[model samples]
Target chain A: MNFIYDPVPWVINWLTQLLLGWGLPINLVNTLLYLVGAVLICLGAMLFTTMLIWAERKIGGRFQDRLGPNRVGPWGIFQSIADMLKIFTKEYINPVGIDKIPFNLAPILAVAAVLAIWAVIPFSETVFGANINVALLFIIAIGGLGEMAIILAGFGSNNKYALLGAFRAVAQLISYEVPMVIVLLIPVMFSGSMGLNEIVQAQKIPFIIYAPVACVIFFICSIAENGRAPFDLIEADSELVAGYNIEYSGLKFGMFFVADFLHAFTSAIVFTTIFLGGWQGPGVEQMPVLGGAYMLIKTLVVYFLMLAIRFTLPRFRIDQMMALNWKILTPLALVTLLVTALVDKSIPHEMTLVRIGALVIVNVLLWLLADRMITAYRKRNPIQVVTGKARPLARPEILPVVEKEAAQ
Target chain B: MTGMQILFLITSAVVLFSSIMSVTAKRMIHSALWFVLALLGVAVVFAMLEASFFAVVQVLVYVGAIAILIIFATMLTRRALEDKGDQFNRATLVTLVIVSIIFAGLVVSLKSWAPLQNLTSPLSAEQLNVGVLGLALTAPDGFTLPFEVTSILLLAALIGAIYVAYERKEKKK
Candidate 1:
């Protein structure tokens, strides 16, 4: 293979030879290489967050009819860097009565939990940190760590508002995870494996075509999981100042901020990997490096779509959010998974066209049926609109009486 | 000692220490967090054993769901937070005796087992593939019955929980 086309293996080979030449043991060299790979992935993800923040702000500004940070540098690209430096220098305010260990550990765990999901994602044919067989489950499992971090931050802060925000966040996260996991089963069922790389390779045609309902549910659930807009009650500004990180300041606070931005983009990357045929395009086989480009392009598209949704939609009420997940998304995802599994088994794998057609038709029909049911339910039990005549304006005579009573 | 053995010993130590702290911690939340650490240590042990499926599942179900629920429940009960009562109660001595007897019995019984006497080689990567585990769980000739029964039990428990939590609304008639 050409060095330019697949530099990762070439670099690995060169390193292996160099380490051997230096007379290091095989096991030690392997361990060192693994550590290097992990550190690189972590650094790459953190650095990428800066760009994500800049892009999100610019897009969000456009959506709100304003110019984003333009003075920092060309297109305000250096804005996040400036913010990073300022945050680095800011003082960490330790609130009184705070639990020292959990408080200090929370931000690190928050960022680490998000970064851990990157370990299994396959950016290209040859580029992945790990090819663990249970990658899909690994993703969900890591999410638990994120939840723990939030709980720790809130509890450690010893602030009532922060605790309340954390409760709301945990509730939303746990509830949404139900549908997300169920939808995830659809892709796994289609690919017959949970390894992300194998899933990517299995996608001769993107799984989304075969399971659009699952795709949509997964997308919505991921957005909710990230606490993005429309499902962002976790950090409701009017209700809780800044949610779980309300008492955190400086770099601790910055870590949480970075986690949030990085998580949004990471979810986008995951969505692309699972649904949009990650790194799979024309000419990818001939030049595997181009697969990385394809992956990035697909991820950006999904990221932009998420940003659009975030900017356009209003946040859901807490009750509405829970109801949507439990009453709607969960049941719908279950049905989709069941239908997809049964249909997939009965059809012969050789007839690709027939299988796809059957799946698409079933998915469309299922969506239509769900829509009709919801519409009928709404008609049967219409939202109560309590209307009454406007109250009469207060008279001057009444106002005087009220003033006299108050004085008394 | 080999690196793997050393790592295993360290993990076991952590697990033991965390489990002790989980029970002995003064604060309920601290106890719960310690419990989580213990669970995570067990997950690490599972990972080291090459049982990636079990390792991930342990973290997902135990650490992710069960531990969080326990912590959430403890938080909801305000009294639990301030509880500074003695960790040991009136029945501590009796419980300790029973636990020790059980531990001794387990050790004696397990020591005589043939499998424990013979050290088997670790499974190859192919043999450890998750697909094999999945097939064994779902195949008709395999563990289908027990698997289905476990799912049913979980479903029943879930429904019972919802029933207990459900609020009844009185009629306005």
Candidate 2:
């Protein structure tokens, strides 16, 4: 791979080494190196997003019992490329009565926010964007910018539906964001460092096992935060007519489109690293090249898992979404946090057995409690009315009649 | 200029420019964006100090969270972005003048105050290790008070935000 004139990586490596040799300190050199990594990350994210769009469509098509994108290249591998070209060459129409400045700025801000957060994400042990100790917070905080961009896009479009959709998005984003940050703190607590790489390494057992409730909350929040399906009421296409980007067409629309797909990819990566013991495959790290490959495969698998969830689940009502977070995730996260702390305290540092036992006990108790709460709450106040006469007191009414005539 | 001095000059200018824009920008959203730029410049200054963690925190907390929240607040306030009247006036000018005077006084004091010349040297690996930051946050003697207080602050912020955003509505079908 480092053979005759690859040019880019070679030149970068050479230049970096030269800087180091010229009496430049290692940290200074690393800072300069990070600039290069940032650009590469942006490029990688774009490529991955494009691929994901194709993969998701094909997978979704298969799920729906249809063939997808069979025309473009072999098995439609190049379909996304064609779509990109179409989007690029399409006419850019600035709608009448729109706020010109914010309208244009919103998409740019959205894309930039996503890309900028990658600057702190550690790709591998050696390969990193930047080793900032506050990387975890940086990722979450930068992610908040995307919500602002969405709100701006909605308002800027000057469309009523867009405005409504944007408002919905803002509320949802801000709501889920509370629990999301709290769940993220679970990792930060265990890692005892805010750096993403250090956080990954801290998971001797993936935080998912040690803190399953936090894991579930984080996953749900990530989906909600990214405006994906089941939680994607903000862009409920059937209801809001493409949501915030209703008026946007051509490149403006493309920006939102690309942002959505890229967001999913990034979310998948985050979920994998935070909860799935990032890049930690058996015997993969021993061989440098294999490690990178394994990491990519794992990431792709996670991305597919997200896609599967997105396509499978029905969209939640906005109220249902809010209720789920406030009633379920927030309380669940709090309990998990307390349980983790207590278990961590009880585990003697010397005995692995005690630690494992504590972890298991905490997990089982959490599941039992959460399951009971969900089911009991559902039973006590069901989501809907049956519109039928009341049943006999002792009759098994789990399957209630939709409609019944009175005995005449 | 040496590299460090050059970095200092660029970042200082960036900070100055953005700070001015943040105050004077006509649009509230523009003002927020300018504030983000100012915070970014502050991060660069932290980088100059070789406090990489602090640099990232400046961006994460100030640029990311604070500025975004400010933008959110601006959006929530009805018609804040539509070029409005009297964002600045005579009273604002007076306030600016007083703030500038205080800033100058502070700068003068800082210039007169002795800096840690010995500690101005580059960081060692041990000092920069990720674990060191954790120790600083959790250690009883170091920043445990601030850390606990920040957690409390976050909780308060959450409650305050929920309060501000809460609406008392007429019960209706």
Best by DockQ: 1
TM-score for each predicted model, relative to the true structure: 0.95, 0.83
Tens digits of per-residue lDDT for model 2, A150-213: 8779878888899888878878987887888877877887777777888877766677777777
Reference-based lDDT, residue A3, model 2: 20
Per-residue lDDT of B1-173 in model 1, one digit per residue for the tens? 89999999999999999999999999999999999999999999999989898999999999889999999999887677578878888999999999999999999999999999987899898888988988899999999999999999999999999999877676333
Writing each residue's lDDT as its tens digit, candidate 1 over A1-408 gives 679999998898899889999999999998999999999999999998998899999999999888988989999999999999999999989999999999999999999999999999998899899899999999999999999999999999989899989988999999999999999988898888899999999987898898999999999999999999999888988989879889999999999999999999999999999998998999889899999999999999999999999999998888778877887888899899899899999999999999999999999998997798678767876876668987766655556776768867
Interface Cα root-mean-square deviation for all models: 0.7, 2.9
- For model 2, the superposed segments whose C-alpha errors exceed 4 Å read A1-37, A97-99, A385-408, B2-7, B116-119, B123-173
Which pairs clash (backbone N, Cα, C closer than 3 Å) in model 1?
none
Give each prediction's root-mean-square deviation over alpha carbons. 4.2, 6.6
Report the C-alpha lDDT of model 2 over B1-173, residue by residue, as the tens digit: 67889989999999999898888888777777778778889988987887877776776677656776787677677777676655767698789899999999998887777773243657897898767878899999999999999999989999998989877576332
Model 1: residue A342 alpha-carbon error in angstroms? 1.7
Top-scoring candidate (lDDT): 1
